[model samples]
Target: MKYLNALRNQWIAARGWMFCTLLLAGLLIYVMQSYVQLSANMPTRLVPYDLHLMEGPVEVGASAGYTDEDYLTEIAVADTQLHSTWTPNNVESQYARFQNRMTPALYAKVGNDLQGRLPDLENSERSQALFVEHTEALEDTVRVTGRLRAWIGSEQVEDRPIAYRVRYAFSDGVPYVAGFSVEEE
Candidate 1:
């Protein structure tokens, strides 16, 4: 109590210093509160106008049934669109293209692959056989699902492209004809 009284008396006497110290404490508190608020809001950051910047080009025709022509066509379309769009640099455009075009193409390819493979499996005694014995590789037998996003050029708007993505899968375990479809957002 005595030491507090002495400190109080000293502070009262040093009005200038006391005012400065109070101001500094208030400033420090304000700064800390602001920092806390900013951190709290970090997760709520706005989605980028262009999502394509973050996601790479969408892959198409990964299925075993996809012929070289189909693969080449898809790739050519994507490449041409990307090259022509002014906003190819924009993230959103890239993402939109992947979602709209590339994803659907991939799904189709997976379905085709499964359809082709399942018929052959019915004849073979080994259901687990990895790949076609003569032509295709063993790794081609496995069905896979994945999601990806890519940017594509807009024919109308050179500066802005579209962003898109697709989530799909193929599974033989489902009993019905194996297939792939886009997942609902």
Candidate 2:
């Protein structure tokens, strides 16, 4: 009877340990499942709290040896603005700035034309301002539509609608002005 009692006590102890182990495992699995569900229900998008700006050289072209659309639009608008708006005092300097933006061939033609008109522009004290109304970026080209107002010696001479199509080409990941034309509208 004493031996039987000892064996019975050992069996109860083993069963108690097994039950405790199984209960702990079940609890862990339930917690894991709850955590997965919570994660699944969370939002994926993040909203930024603050904007940080860093100063550096701007990357103008794409990595795949192509012109970036945003960069092209920005350049086209800026170049057109520079070309369209100028006073007699600044026309030479503004036109000179195009040497950097334009292809050598195009710049040569433009330089000659502007040079020929330089005397007249300066003598008349001409000034022009462009008000940009619409800007569109297309494949390989940008179309900028605006109103051009011209003044000669403080007298308003003309106010007219204007549209410019600026063509761009990439060489070694650098964009250059390939063609520029005034679109008749």
Candidate 3:
């Protein structure tokens, strides 16, 4: 309390220029901190993949039985958008960073399953998707099976091939994944 009183007395006795400078500096710091906090909560637009970057299969198709091309196209776009956000070949320490980068809409499609599969996909260098196979279709629920070559290291694990079976349903015209599971191929 004594120190604060002394500082206040000193500030009042200081020259006008010094007092104004100190006041401006304090105000500047407050504005910058507020701006940083505001921007931190806002969603940022980031494109992880290069505009001309091309990797993996150009076409994604199922084993058979899928007739809806529009749905397949949507699935491909979502997969491509999300895959580009996965952590690069750094290490397990940086592997889970991709989950934080996903936008709310993008996250809605695969949030449940993808979040759980981060560990398995940590070392995935790349994949060549066979295609999206629609196995079950109902009024609201649709099931899609995806086959891809998951490369961990230099060696490709193929003996127990894995495929994702995602179940999707529409809520107010927006499709969301109810759940997903990996099936052995």
- Candidate of highest lDDT: 2
lDDT of 3 by residue, 67-164 (tens): 24455335533533344323334423332343444445646776666557665665556433334444454433344445444444555553333444
List, residue by residue over 1-185, the lDDT tens digit for candidate 1.
99999999998889978889999999999999999999988864334456567574332234435324333333333433332222313424543443343334453655355345444444433211011111111221222222223223222211222322212233321111122232222
TM-score of 2: 0.62
Which consecutive 10 residues in model 3 have the weakest lDDT in total?
57-66
lDDT of 2 by residue, 1-185 (tens): 99999999999999999999999999999999999999999866422333245253334443553445766787888889878899988887777776578888887778688678777877767799988898898767999999999998879999999999999877755678888999755
When summed lDDT is taken over every stretch of 10 residues in candidate 2, the lowest stretch is: 45-54
List where candidate 2 sits over 4 angstroms from the true fold: 1-66
Cα error of candidate 1 at position 113, Å? 43
| Model 3 regions lying over 4 Å from their true place | 1-14, 40-144, 150-153, 157-162, 168-178
> Candidates' TM-scores?
0.21, 0.62, 0.37
Taking the candidates one at a time, how many backbone clashes does each contain? 19, 0, 1
